[model samples]
Target: MALATLGVVVPGIAAFYEFVVKGRKRLGYRVQMDTTATNVVETDDPGVFDQLREPLVDPTLVLLRIENNGQTHIDEDDYAVLHDKKAGVTITFPDRKVVGMVVTELSDDGMRSSFEDGGGLAVKGSRILLPKVPMNRGAHYKVLAALDTMNGKMDQYPPPKVACTIKGGVTGGKIQETRSRTGTPKRVIALIVFLVAIVVAQLVVFTQSNNGAPLDCASGHLNVTGSTAFAPIAREAAKSYQDLCPDATFGFDMRGSGEGLQFLDQAGRDGKADGQLTFSDGEKPDDMPGLLPRPIAFFLFTLVVNKDSGVADLTGDQIERIYQGKITNWRAVGGNDLAIRLISRNPGSGTRNAFQRRVLGGVREPGTNSDDCRNRDPGSPPGVVRCARDSTDAVLRTVESTPGAMGYSELGAATGRAGLTAIRIDGHPATVDEADHGAYPFWETEFGYTAGEPAANSLAASFLRYLTNQVGADIIRSYGDRPCAELANPQLCRPT
Candidate 1:
């Protein structure tokens, strides 16, 4: 009877390890594609392949994908290698020599810097060494390697031998060599189906126990209205929340920040504020007693100029002078002799308010002079051509089209736009790291405002909780903003 119990208990433990414990810190790798099957070596004309400097007798291209296919994040310090060792894993191609390798794709652009020269990504002999890259859940990167079979026949292409010499810090962790999607084993498929069914059953039980309401879910409609600069993050977060809670819905009315606050104020006075929410670029006014504020993230803003401007950096004094109409032409600031056009946001814009408070020293700029922003208005002075735009997109478009035009916009909105360059301030780039270290000043604390506090179980309250959680923080960081909760100094998000 003891032996029989041991037999059953051992198998149960094995199944639990295989299905549950094994996936918590898994490092999965797979050969996405091998060019051996399609190699047609034309020996007569080697000149056709001039793209490679080194001549190859028998070339094979291998695309390898390495991922953190696990539930938790894998930090760089989690690698189980020596302290001085740079490589986390070494992949060997038997009977083949590695000619070159390049990182092809990344799940997140922030991982690109990890593949730089000193990050341990190198090709030595028949092996490719990889760095200890930290990966969040579902994050992956692809490396495309050019390999030669040492003049061996290409017909018998041996599979790669992946060894985790550089990647061993995980508990109960083993680096797995996975097959292609079509070659997945039947037993693995059955196990996955079984685990999914178990999870579904648990979820059903949990919902039933909670009186028919799902975890972290509220059934209602919410209207998210606020800073157009933060609209991208807001929309993404709302979409993710709706996906998690199918009964919930969201409507967006992203006007300027001040406008959004005023709209929420009126909604609160009318007792319709329960369904309305607004996000501001900074703190709300002291006059609005009923409204409550919660800091969500730190948004970075930058000054952008047309490509023809030839100016890259500006001092705070120079910017203030330009807005104050003391400087007129681009040549005055070491650029071409073109006339300077100022594209600015309107009075109700929160971004404009932040700029005035932080950069302009609480001083307001001269009123908008030109309606078209090209030439001065008929009765206005013939100095700087100043105009006001209602939204961040309008400011960027105007700065992109008009030569010598300059404007300020959210960093994410200004990035990668053609014909405009995001300039620096006092030689400091507009980056989260820079802002954290106090080198950058063009940023603001983004706040989510409600009309007093919504009920604990209300949709507005639940959505606010979700916005500060890990999922919403990821979405916020993806757009180049830094969530306040993740800040090195949490006090930075507080009202000054």
Candidate 2:
């Protein structure tokens, strides 16, 4: 009875093993495998070795080998890392497709294989001793092995290809081969050439447009030189005009009215410039060329003081006294007892010239008895405070910092300084509206100067039209300047 039981148990165990091993093969179930094919395989069918190949999907590892072929030792810096040392490889596929891939490597016994995100396609280390587990069969594959260096220098390498096969008891395997693609380099070169041609063409267009017909009503580059007071308004106007006519450009220089007139006078005689605008107080200079044209825009010069000076207004006579070195203390002007520190422009300033002509009536000298003025002349009379600043920004800086300091500046510059206050002139507030309506006592027009009538219908004319337009006016106002139309008595042409 014991012997019979043992025989029955042994047969049953053998049958169970056979069923587990061969069940899927007999049923003809296909197994989808990973790229390495190292994982155990399973099947629904009991039996079937017939394999179908799926195209090798996107690869993760691409090995590249670069060879110098020359005998020179290459430095490490000569080679650039791929993707800036990030984990990507460059490769060519068996189908001649080129791609950069990311992959993982596994090694055993001095042999290596790579795995990527794609389906089960892998390169085995040794073919004879270690047959590849089959992926879906018949798929083509190519893999770059690794980056290699010649003479200690790293470089790129061509990839290797492999075909899938199954033989004998081995259900899957990979075969190594080579692949080549034609015309790829030529295509890349052609693309680069096309891009370069486009860039050159654009450059030519830009150059031609910039150098086009001068000032022919189309608006070319206009050189504007005159009062710094007018510079902000003119600059804003030029920019606005350029926006309207993109091809036109304007150049402005903030030379004083005298310098502008001088340039215009010279250019007029030499037939160089087209128009002239002078911001003089209508006391036209004797030497000013009769041919030069007149003003275009009027601007005002006003006295600006420290906001804490407690002075809000001044009469012309009081201003004369303050600038002439009469009033040395703010208390005299209804303010605290701080010593008045007066600031004035350089003698050559158009603003200075205009102030002398209008406010001083050309009689009172600036350096008379005022501590603010320092005498360059040995026997000169006492002078007003000589700030000797170069630009409006400089003058404002002094006024804002020096307690009880008073200076004259363009209304635009004085508008927003923290410590500065603009005084009402003769009871009328210094404002854009007042200046526009001619109510502001300090209001005046600015001018541009050119030699002759601008070349018929040139860029100069276009620029002038643009300056007078609503758009340009809007920009001027935005910059704390009254627009040209606003300065007009009727004030009808409002900025749009």
Candidate 3:
């Protein structure tokens, strides 16, 4: 009986060893790697992963293909967030000394990263990317990875290591790259006569406001768009730039800063320029490939409520809870007995993004980004957060009309507007004077972005260059935000 039992147990153990251990080995032995063909860029296209912190990094896509060439089937799983949740895989770049790779999957559209959603999974043989790594152009890299599974063991992110190299990219030729004569000799003769008459009628209206400055430009047009927070400054700066180069025209209208970055992305990525949007202003975006951000000024976002509400102040903790939907009543926060009506901006709005990030500390505000706004409502009976308005004036009016309504907006937008009262956060009054001097805690730098450095002769490039000058500084201050002329804080400092 003992011999019979020993024979059965011994065979089972050997079979298990052959199936598991040998299978992983064979899988690793037969792995392969494949990379897509691409080119290096001449112009510097900068991008940032952590908008509020990280330095600019160029966007370089790296895709790796892993296959099973072994005689055995090696079961595997590749999921960045899920893998981490279930005891993730071990990956490394010996050349860069980066270990523990967190692989992410594509979005439903398969056009974006699921890093935010934290959902990427793979089984058996598949292809994966080097989850948004900043790599130097015109260079080679060695990547290695490993993983664990239910049925069998795993090795490396794709099994065997691969060394890949990158080269420079090329662009198409510009349209009408040279000059051409448009008029005939007879037309030119008439043009010369017309020019003489124009010079005789030309009168210089020199006012003290001009300060002896004259319209001194040739001819060109540029559109400045996005970031209503910075619109005043940008619009005013257009006048200043025109003072130096009057032949050039600039367009800046009312639009959210977040939408401005999208304009830049569309222009940079698809090479399609908007008829009236040449530059975009706002907080820098996370992915900034083929672009650069210049921090020009600083501004604050203030919390405001209907003047009729009895609430005057709130602690940071209480304010956070209010947005979290934990404290649903105005009375709960020392206000009149009323249901707190939460008013919020769209996710695409730059002001909303700043308020959420700075005030909520990355926590989702209740009733925002959900079937409504977030996940839950912050009212007494639990209701969807209401849209205040896209325009600052409109938002202020909405809050004033709706009793118990509270919302956030740029300090400049709420100030001087009737029927709205700005609330103090943590005993600190939200004001431009306080925020500019760093007395207030809630403020963010205004950013302008472009596709690398603009061409030397391009008016858009010239305008950006002028934006850093003293004239630009003066114009930025005229807006609600303070232009950081001499500041040590990186957020306020000008980006090189």
lDDT of 2 by residue, 247-350 (tens): 66766666666666776677767766653333332333666645334345446568898876889898888888887778877899788877777777766677
Give the runs in model 3 whose Cα sits over 4 Å from its true position.
Answer: 1-219, 273-282, 368-381, 431-439, 488-491, 494-496
Candidate closest to the true structure, highest TM-score: 1
Model 1 / residue 403 / CA error / Å: 1.0
What is the Cα-based lDDT of residue 119 in candidate 3?
24
C-alpha lDDT of all candidate models, in order = 0.80, 0.49, 0.51
Alpha carbon lDDT of residue 195, candidate 2? 43
Candidate 2, overall lDDT?
Answer: 0.49
lDDT of 1 by residue, 178-281 (tens): 66575434564344334433433453366455464447888899999989999988999988888878889999999889999999998899998988999999
Clashing pairs in 1: 80-169, 88-166, 88-167
Weakest 10 consecutive residues of candidate 2 by summed lDDT: 25-34
Error of 1 at 287 (Å): 0.8
Model 1 lDDT, full chain set: 0.80
In each prediction, how many residue pairs overlap at the backbone (N, C-alpha, C within less than 3 A)? Answer: 3, 59, 21
Candidate 3 worst ten-residue window by lDDT: 168-177
